[model samples]
Target: MPARVFVALMVTDSGALTAAELAQTLRVSPAAVSGAVRYLTRLHLVIREREPGSRRDIFRVRDEAWQDALANRDALLAQYSGSFAEGVSVVGRETPAGRRLTEAMEFFEFLRKELDGLMDRWRAHRDAPRPDGPPA
Candidate 1:
């Protein structure tokens, strides 16, 4: 999969790779690589860049890929919670189905709030000095 290829590149010393290079490394077709890159690009997990003095389009994972991915879930959470709330209203608050929807909506709302706090804590931790030593 393209995600696996991206992870491979991340673990390797070479942090970026051309489509052909990625296909070769992953034993997949160039078209597969392209599709993967396109998906990742849309999700803001990967970026496309030109190799200086070359025409090759290199694909590399963004530095904040994880953070961006996690943050993007807020929109999905909000949509799910909204839909659940609507379901509860349609089913009537006293019904079992309505209670289930209410529980789900509450859970999602809690997660949405916690996600914001978690991201903030992560940023602080990321910026904090390392007592052990510099990062590898």
Candidate 2:
């Protein structure tokens, strides 16, 4: 697990590193690092590359990886929204069941709005310039 932590930190910085280098930095055996790398790779979170002059494999986190992951999450919410819409229709607008479904739909609708707001804030933050001096 320490190796995985090291791998995460390593990739977070420059997005690429070799297994041997990771092992040395983490003070673990090459086998251990290799195992962790293999696991991360299998999860599709990491990709492997080979240098032209070396046999060591470099592991990297795919560009826009989190974007794809979040898209998958939003897709699920959209699917649920469709199902909840059906619930609202089936229960009819005047009944208690209909009211409950409407509430559920409203809740998810609010969630979707909040997610949009969050993404807006995230983009704003990402585009904002960093401070030049030390923090207070």
Q: Which numbered prediction scores highest in lDDT against the true structure?
A: 1
What is the C-alpha RMSD, rounded to one decimal, of candidate 1?
1.7
lDDT of 2: 0.70
Total clashing residue pairs per candidate? 0, 0
lDDT of 1 by residue, 1-136 (tens): 7677678668767688898989888889988888988888888888999999999998888888999999999999999999999999899878999999999999999999999999999988888778897532
Q: For each candidate, what is the lDDT?
A: 0.88, 0.70
Which candidate's TM-score is highest? Answer: 1
Report the lDDT tens digits of candidate 2 across residue range 15-114.
7877777777777888887788777665556678996698867877766555544544665677777788898888796799888878887787777778
lDDT of 2 at 79: 74
Checking candidate 2 for backbone clashes, the offending pairs are none
Lowest summed lDDT window (length 10), candidate 2: 1-10
